[model samples]
Target: MVKFLLLALAFGLVHAYAELEGTWYTTAIAADNVDTIEEEGPLRLYVRELTCSKGCNKLGVTFYVNANGQCSKTTVTGYMQEDGKYRTQFEGDDRFKPVHATPDNIVFISQNVDRAGRTTNLIFVVGKGQPLTPEQYEKLEEFAKEQNIPTENIRNVLATDTCPE
Candidate 1:
């Protein structure tokens, strides 16, 4: 019975990951360190796509970053851990957790520890083509408060002119 239950649980997790795959747009990004999400900062990411393996044990993120008035595309792959978090090495060692994910929306929180041992907490809220609704913004604010990320640290990437459509 225990083995059966474990198998069921694994299936459920894999299914959830499959649903997260596809095109996505960045609505907002928040960081505990403002510099990290500022202009030309490594954490200022605008998501373009998310893909998952057949088993959902691996995840891929394709995103854009603005540097020197140019938009650069980058892809990062993450391996799923037993604890349900995805770990990747990009601009640092990053562990990402999808706090909320549905067919239309996704919210991910990540912790990044750089080579210098500087830690940064990040939150990314994304959706399809539409921007975040008011309620989503409210929830993001609550999350920022809980994570101790300053209100001013939240950025609306779509509002910026640097990134391409």
Candidate 2:
């Protein structure tokens, strides 16, 4: 039974987390996102077909970073809870909390797990021109504050990048 279910996702018969899988890009230049490589493109996340199997199934979140026209990738476990929410890190940074996401975009907040200090938000336009809605901004405002970053910065980060034509 597990093999069958896993095969379904592997063969495209199922979209385990359709909303969470995609090439999400952002020009947000804080400390915790895809800011390490500036000239490439927005940071991206894509699903790994086979990661782990369980009730909800373990989703693999791969970050694609392009540097000098070459893209390098890394995989991270995106755990999906029963409520259908995914909790993953921002490129291995525990400072960034669970991925606040939607099919069109994501709102990721970065606050140290220990809560000693530091907060930042990395919002992305998952699809072309699919910027976070105004309501979404209002939604993550507290997270932005808790991360010690100004809400304006979230807007700026998500808005700074545009897909190349």
Candidate 3:
């Protein structure tokens, strides 16, 4: 939301797919509805990697999800649309937009419509090489607030040990 220089830079360069391709770890997420991301929730995803190919027209995302105390891996390949959103099918009809990217981290705003026609909005943050910094976490919280998502809904994925290595 341009509240900080780093976040401002990230939002401006969202089209730079090169910076978004790499292994990434789940850092934090904020959702309009907490149950969608709570323990064993359908949208509780931990990203493993992001691969952008074909001049950034296609995006491959590999992630892990914990359900029934078991961690499972799922990969989804989304095609980029003219509107800069990647459309893919996963738990439902999913679409995501890269909202921010830096050398070490990236952020996405995702919308998912489940089979029951329920829509969920989520802001996901992922970091590479190392865990996210406190300042970065703060920025995420700020960004979530601007999206009308309560900062309290922000969950620190790294703080949990449910996901697999």
Say which candidate scores most in TM-score. 1
Question: What TM-score does candidate 1 reach?
Answer: 0.89
lDDT of 3 by residue, 1-165 (tens): 446988767655555787888888888888998899877788888898899888778999999998888999999999998888999998899999888887888899999999999988999888864666889888888899888899899888866636665
Q: Which candidate is the best by lDDT?
A: 1
Residue lDDT tens for model 1, 64-129 = 988888899999998989898999998889999899888888999999998899999999888886
Candidate 3: give the clashing pairs: none
Ranking by lDDT: 1, 3, 2
Please report, as a residue range, the 10-residue window in candidate 2 with the lowest summed lDDT: 41-50
Q: List residue ranges in candidate 2 displaced over 4 A.
A: 1-53, 78-99, 110-129, 134-142, 152-165
Candidate 3 residue-pair clash tally: 0
Q: For each predicted model, how many residue pairs clash, with residues at least 3 apart or on different chains?
A: 0, 1, 0
Candidate 3 stretches greater than 4 Å from native: 1-15
lDDT of each: 0.86, 0.45, 0.85
Query: How many angstroms is residue 163 displaced in model 2 relative to the true structure, after the best TM-score fit?
Result: 9.6
RMSD of each: 2.0, 8.1, 6.3
By TM-score: ranked, best first = 1, 3, 2
